[model samples]
Target: MILDSSLNITLDNSNNAVFRILGEERFKITNAGPDIGGRLQFSNGRYIHASVQDDPDVDELRFKASGHLDEPLRIYGGSNYNKRVGIGRLSESPSRPNEDMSRFGLDLQDTGNGYLYGLRLTNDTTGTGGSNGACIYYENSNMYVRNFTGGPIKFKTKGAQAMVIASNGCIGIGGITNPMYTLQLGFVNSNSGGAQRHANWNYLNSSNNSFKQLNGNYGNISIFVGGHISINGVIVCVSDKRTKTNIYPMNPVKSLDNLRLLNPVHYYYKDFINNPSQLQAGFIAQETKHVLPTSLEMAGQSIPNILASASYYVDSFKNKIIQFSDFDTSKLELDNSGNFYPYLRVFDEENDIELPYWITISKILSSNSIQIETKEELPSRVFVYGQYVDNFHLLHYHRVFTTFVASMKEVDAELQKEKLKTLELQREMNELISLVQTIQK
Candidate 1:
C-alpha cells in the first residue's frame, strides 16, 4: 500500500510488515508473538519523534542528525522551555519539577534558570510521600551534591567506605562515621577489637584550632596565630647511624673557640610587639653562622659567590673595596649599584674577631676597582661573606649540637690542665717547707 508520495508499506513472506520512504527501507515490524514482543527497527540515522499532545504543531521530542555510525543517537526536547525526563513514578503536578515526590527512580530536569540542570534520585519503599535520597544539581554558579536523608555521602573502595562527606559539610577519611570537625581521619584498629582510632583537625572556630587524637591518649599539636606552634609531646629527630655519611670528629679547641664567638641574647620578635616583656633566648642566626659556618644550611640551592676569588683591600678612607679583574661591570650599572649591596666582613687576625660591615657600591670605578663605601671603618684584611640571595639568610639552628658538645670537651680539657698545675704547685710548696725545716735543725 502507498500512503503518500514518499511512504510505502508491504508485507514480507513471513507476514512481517515493512515500511519504506523514498524507496529506502526506513522501518520494519516483525510478526513475533506477544511473549517474544514484535520487533520494530529503524534504519541508521532515523529516529521516532514524540509529542505530548496530538496536535501536529507541538513536537516535544526531536531527533538530531548524526553523520557517523559511531555517533550517539541524540534526542532534543521542545524549544523555548525547560523540560524534564522522568523514569518510574512522577509527581502529580508536571509543572513543579522540584516538588518532593516520594517516587522511586531518577529525574533529570532543566529548571531554565541560566541552563541549570538537576538530577534527583528518590527511593520511597514504604509508599508514603516522604522524599529521602540524593540530589546532584547545578545552580548559581556552583554544583551541589545533597542528600536529603541526613546521611553522609560515602565513597567506597575495596568493599569499604574510604571517605565520607557528612551532611554538615565535614569530611572523613578511613571509615570515620561521625566527624566532629571539618576534616577527620580514622582507622579500624584490629588490636583494639575494631575500635575506631581517629584524629581530628578541628578548625571550626578561630579560638579552637587543634589537631589531636580523639579516642586515644595521644597529645595534641596546636598551631596558633602569630607563628607559634605548641606541641604537647617531646619532639624527636631521626638520628640513625645508617642514615649518615662522611662522619668525622670535630676539633675540640677550634669548636670551643667558634662556640664562644656566638653571643646568646634575650629579645622579642619584631612582630610580637604586644608582649614586649616576653623575651626569647637564642643565638642570632647571622652571628651563629659566622661562628659555625658549616652548621648553616641554605634554604634552597646554594648561590655561587661571584667575588669569592676576588681580592679585597681597604682604601684610604678605610672603606673596603673588592677587586676582580674578570668581574662583569655591564651587569652592575652605577645607577643600580646600591641595590646590589654585598655583605662584607674582616677577620682581625690579632684580635681574633670577625667585624661585619655592609658595602654600598658608590661607583663602578672599572671592573677591577668597584668603589664602595662602608658604614664604618673596616680592618686591614677584608673578606666577602657573599651577597644575600633574596634579602634573607636561613640558618639551621639544630645542626649546632655537635659543635656545642665539642666546646664542652674543650672546657673539660682546660679544667684538667688547671688541676695538674695546682697539684704541681702544692708538691713544690711542700718540698720548700721541708728544706726550710732541715736548715733550721
Candidate 2:
C-alpha cells in the first residue's frame, strides 16, 4: 500500500461519503452533519477520529483525528482539552503572554493519566486550541508538530507547581524538538516561571539568552529564580561540533558584558577617600595594574618591572662569569670602615674585565700563615666604577691604588722568613764544597 502525494478522494453524497481506502479495507464516515456540512474531501478532509500511523521515529500513534471543515480547522487526540471545563476566563497581557496560560484553561485528569496527539503542518502557519482565545493550554502524552515555518510554540501553565516543560525530551530550547510526557524546563514554581533556553548554537555563547522550553528530564535539570547554576549539568552539544560536549564553557571569559551584575565587588560604596569601614579587610592586596581584556578575550599580562630588574642583574652576573675566566675563583674583599669592597679583575690581554676597584677583605680569616686579624684591600678604581649591587651612589675604590705605592720599610713577616731560608741554604752549600776538598787530599 504505497500512498504517494498524488492520492486523492472526494465525498459529495451522504451515505457513501468520504471513504478512506487502506491496504485492503475501505473506511467510510459512520456519522456526518447536515447536507453541505457532511462533505469530506482529501484536501478538505473531515473524519470522526483520524487513524494516525504508529511511528517510533515521531513518538506518536498511527491513527488520530482530523479537524472540522470550518474556516479555522483544528484536530485533537483522546485527551483533547476542548471538552474539559476551563478553570477561569483566559486573559491577555499587553506586554507579553502570561506564563499561566493553563490557569485560564483546561485541567487534565488526576495524576497517573495522560493523552497523545499528532499535528501535520501543510502550510506556512496554522493555529489550534481556540479560534479567538488568549490562555489556551493543552496536555498530552505526546505531541508532534513539524513540516511548518518557524513560528515559536507557546505553552502557559495555570499555577507555579513543579511542572516540566520540554522540547525534545531535553530541557534546552533550540535544536530538534522531542515529543514525550514528563517534559520540564525551568523551575518557577509560583511567580511566573519560564526559561527561553536556547540550544540554538548561535545564542548559547551569549549571556542573558535562555532556552524557552524543555521536553523531558524535569528533576534532572531545572532553571528558576535564585537558582545557582549546577556544577556539571547535562552537556548540550551537536555531533558535528568540535567539542562534542557542552559541559564546560568552550568560549573565553571576556564574553561577559555584565560581569559586575553577576559578581559585584562593593556591597555598597563607602566614602570617596580613606574610609576604614569602606575597605575590605580580607582584600589587602590591591590590583596594581591590569590589562583590561576586550569584550571577548582574556586579560593579557606583562612582565613585572621589579622582576625584570632582578633578572637583568642575574644575567649580568652570568655574563661576567663568561667574560672573566677566573671570576669564579676571585673573591670579594669588603672593608667595614667605609663599606669598600675589592673584587678580583681579569686584566688578561684577551679579557679586560674589571675586578672590584677596591679589594677589602673582612669578616672571614684566610688560610694564609700570619693570620692577620683583619685584612682590607681597596682598589684604586673604587671611585670610578662602583660594585655589582648599588643601593646608593656608585663607588670607584680601585682608582686609589693607581698613584699609591706600597712601603716595604715594614715588610710582612712572611717575607722575612723567606729571606732567612735563602741565607741558610747558601751556608749549607759552602760546607758541602769544603767536605769535597778534604776527600781529594
Candidate 3:
C-alpha cells in the first residue's frame, strides 16, 4: 500500500523495532544514534539498503543496491557526504561496507583487482535509432560523444575561453575561429601590433634553457642558436657577397707562403679506427694555430678570407666563360715578342715538356676536341657542357694559375732589367767609339 502521509514507528517501548513494507520483508533497527540501517524494496527485483553498525571492527554504514544472490552486476551510490560508492559483481549481500576508493575515485573490485572509471555514460541501441538523441552514446564496448546539433565544445580557464572544439571538429587554441588545420594555435592581434612578426613556436628544456630560436626580426626569418648549427649532417653557412662590406683583396703570395708553412700530414683519426685505410690529408689544428691562428676556432679550423677571394675569382672566371663569344681568340696570336700560345698547357712534375693535366685528362676521356659555344652556334647541350667544363677547370686551374702568375711576374721583371742593361751597354759602346774618333781627329 502507498502511504499518503508520513509514517513514523516510535521505539519508545522496545530497544529493537521492526517495520514491514508490502508485507514481504521486515526492516529492523537496534539503537537510535548517528548509525541507521534499513532496507527498501523499490520494485519486484530492485532493492535499496542502508545498514549502520556500532562495532569498531565492522562497517559504520553501508548503502547498497542489492538484488538476487546470483545477479551478475550491482551498482550503489552511498550518501554523497561520505565520498564513496561502488559498482561491481558481488555474490553475497554486503554484511559490511567496503570503505575503499580506487585511484579513479570509484571502489570497483572483483576478486582482488578491478578498474575504476570516473564517469561512464552509455546508450544501448542499434543502428540509427539512438542517433541525434544524446551527446554520449555507447555501442557495445565503444563510446562516443557527438554533437548532433552544430555547436562548439569549449574549454575555459577563469571563465575565459582557452580552447574550442568547433562544430566542424577542428580544435583551436586562443581563438574560436574554425581552424584551417587539424590543430591551430591562434594569436590575438595576429595582423596588428607586430604580433605576426614574431616566432610562432617556441620550446624549452627542463632547465628552461633555449637551444634554438626561430625569429623574424629584420623582415626575414632566421634562426638564432647558442653554437654552430648543422643542416642534414652538413655544416653550412650563408656567405652572400652582396651582404658583405669593407672588403679588401688578399696578397696571394703571403697567403700561399703561410699555407706552405703549415705542413699537411696523411693521417687517419683514431676515432675512426675501423676505417684506417681512409687517410685524410690536412694540417693538424695545433700546428695550423702556430701559423694561421685566425682560421682556428673552438669548433674546428677553416680557411680564412683567402677562400672567399678565391671563390670570387672563380665566379669571375665563370662570367668570362659565359661571355666567351665576345672574346677575340686572335689575342692568342703572337705578341710583339713573337711568342704565341694557342693553349696554355700548365704542366705537373715541374717538367717543361710534360703534358698538362687538362690536356692529359681530355685525351684520357677522349674529349680533346673542344666544342666551343658561340653566339651563332649556341647548342643547348654544348652550352651546358661548356658550363660544366668551365666549372671543373676553374677548380683545379685557380691554384695553378696563382703560382704561375707569381712566377711569370718574376720572370717579366728580370726580362725588363736585362733589356735595360743591354741598352746601357750599347750607350757605353757608342760613347767609347766617339771618344776614339775624337782622338784620331
Reference-based lDDT, each prediction: 0.53, 0.29, 0.39
Candidate 2 residue lDDT tens string, 1-441: 224364423344454443443322234443332222223323225332222435322111112134522222222223322222122112111111124323123232222323221222233244533222122223554334422233335443463223323433333222224424333233333323433332121223256666444333332333322212443457462345654565553122232222212222444223222133443421101221121212122111111111100000113322211121122212332344655243322122223333323322232222220111113332212211212322212112121111111212223334677788888988888999999999999
Ranking by lDDT: 1, 3, 2
lDDT, candidate 2, at 131: 26
lDDT of 3 at 147: 50
What clash count goes with each model?
A: 0, 63, 0
How many pairs of residues in model 2 come into backbone collision? Answer: 63
lDDT of 3 at 201: 48
The digit string of per-residue lDDT tens for model 3 on 192-232 reads: 22343333444455586755443444434433232224564
Better of 1 and 3 by lDDT: 1
Sliding window of 10 residues with minimal summed lDDT for model 3: 304-313
Superposing every Cα of model 1 onto the true structure, what RMSD results?
19.0
| TM values, all candidates | 0.37, 0.15, 0.29
Poorest lDDT segment (10 consecutive residues) of candidate 1: 31-40
Best by TM-score: 1
